[model samples]
Target: MLSITGAVANSNGQKVFKTLKNEELHCSEAEMKAHLANLYEQQKGKCAITGIAMHLHGQDDCDSDMLVSPDRIDSYGHYSIGNVQFVCRFVNFWKMAQDNNRFAELLDRVVANRVADTV
Candidate 1:
């Protein structure tokens, strides 16, 4: 959560919180931490997009793909409670700056094609 908060901090060192509608919101580190914990539980330790189980950072067997990452549902939006979701690190990287629904559709197609090819 610290990393995420730091990433969204403005030049003045204040966290820049914005909704998808471009409305400004205020979020402190403590708020972010709590929000993230809630999201982790709400998501059942799975990636929102891929539904794959996620592992905490620095776990003994955690790989990049299995690591949990905080993702903004709308890439254009800043980090806010409503806009953030937990996802696999690889999924987050693959979905960067794309609309969530569109990315999911694309991912589904890719998976289907891969399955067909393998079969």
Candidate 2:
């Protein structure tokens, strides 16, 4: 994808947007899995928020449950917190439909619960 940086003058004296620069964030599957493992372990085999066990499938193989749009994600993993949760599929599914406020509320609730449980 291209990113804009500065403005340039056009023939009609109107400012035309131009591409400033571009680079790719390459992440191989193996590296991704490693990162995911770290996140999974950090959360103690459960979601960072919900504290539910993460599931991939019958085989239980999921390196990262990536958000379709990175922009939509929260402030982890650049909105791509890899394997950062262990929620049931249903909860994960719910994430997709939640608005920003609702998502924040859910995460807050889960984190609070986890903290309380620990105490």
- lDDT leader: 1
> Candidate 2 on 1-119: residue-level lDDT in tens?
12332332225576668864332334665765676667656756664445555545344465445221122233223323332344445555667635545776987898899999999
> What pairs collide in candidate 2?
47-86, 52-86, 53-86, 54-86
Residue 23 accuracy (lDDT) in model 1: 40
Model 2 C-alpha RMSD vs. true structure (Å) is: 12.3
Each candidate structure's TM-score, on Cα atoms with residue i matched to residue i, is 0.75, 0.40
Per-residue error (Å), model 1, residue 22: 10
lDDT string for model 1 (1-119, tens) is 98878766745766667755454445987898999999999999999998999998778988877799988888888788889999999988889789999999999899999999999
Q: How close is candidate 2 to the true structure, as a TM-score?
A: 0.40
Off by over 4 Å in 1: 1-25
Cα distance off (Å), candidate 1, residue 21 = 15
